[model samples]
Target: MNILEVNNLNKYFRQPTEFHVLKDLNFNVEKGKLTSITGKSGSGKSTLLYLLSTMDTDFDGSINISENEIKGKDNNWLANFRNEHIGFIFQFHFLLPEFSVFDNVMLPALKLGKLSKEEIENNAFELLCLLDVADQGKKKASLLSGGEQQRVAIARALINQPTLIIGDEPTGNLDSQNTAIVLDLFKELCKEKGQTILTVTHDEDFADRSDRIIHLKDGRIVT
Candidate 1:
């Protein structure tokens, strides 16, 4: 089944002129699949991601995530929906520098308030363990090495058990060993937990290894 569906998507930037960034895009992301979006610079890969993640409402299209249309929702509605249904990881870990690794992972679930505090704590620790960073949970997020920090970030993203995980060059900053760790983690999420992932990446090997790659050029899918 499709966890995400996009149809007739179009995005434009206005200022100098009405320049279109994404044009008539259409796609579906299958549940339990790891999909990558690949493109050259200015090909609207990131722009398309922003729209799919419901961060940019200025675009024209129908985007249905988890079977609900997100086109007309307000920021407040979108924010709440996103917190519950979508998880995000960026090139930078984006963990709070001063927060402990455990706290950083628990923040989203704490805000969600769907689970008991004890349950959230258990899940947070479990995720950290799953990500192989349980030992670092007590330290400040900034104190860990880059790979450790990224693992913590992934743990944070999974704490909420989002319907879909979206990543923007999640391994962009990592060394080869760390990159392999993350790539393996993504595969594990899909095969073991039946999670769906959609990531935008410049890493050719990463794209090639994914279940599928959506290649874009001139704001349109060329492959």
Candidate 2:
């Protein structure tokens, strides 16, 4: 089944005299698959992702995720929807330096408040272990190495068991070995555990290894 559907999507930036960032895009992302979006620096990959994540509401189009249409939603509604249904992993490990790795992982679930604190803690730890970062759970986020920190970020993203995980150059900061590890983890998550993922990356190897790749050029999908 399709987990996400986008139709007639368009985005514009007026700050520099009205430049279109995404142009009439249409696509569907199936459940339990890892899809990658690839493009050059100005090809609107990141802009499209933000729209897909519902964090940029200034677009004109229909974005349906898990059967819910996100167009026209207020910021408050969008924020709640995002927390519950979508997880995000960015190039930078955006963890709170003062918080422990475990706490960073549990933060989102705590904000979500759908499960008990104990259950959330358990889930957080389990995710860390799954990502091979369980031993670093008690350490402050700043203490972990770059690769370890990224793994922790991945664990945090999975803590809520989101319907979809959105990644923006998730492995950009990792070494080659760590990049391979993350790609394999994504494959396992999709093929074995049935997770849906969409990522935007410049890493050729990463894009090539994904279940599917969508090429964008000059704000439009290309064949």
Leading candidate by lDDT = 1
lDDT of 2 by residue, 1-223 (tens): 9999999999999996998889999999999999999999999998999889998888888999999999888989999999999999999989999999999999999999999999998998889888999999999999999989998988888888999999999999899999999999999999988999999999999999998999999999995
Whole-model lDDT for model 2 versus the true structure?
Answer: 0.93
- Give lDDT per model, in order: 0.94, 0.93
Clashes (backbone N, CA, C under 3 Å), per candidate, total 0, 0
- The sequence of per-residue lDDT tens digits that candidate 1 reaches over residues 1-223 is 9999999999999979999999999999999999999999999999999988999888888999999999889999999999999999999999999999999999999999999999999999899889989999899998999999999999888989999999999999999899999999999999999999999999999999999899999999988
Model 1 misplaced regions, further than 4 Å: none
> Which ranges of candidate 2 are over 4 A from the true structure?
none
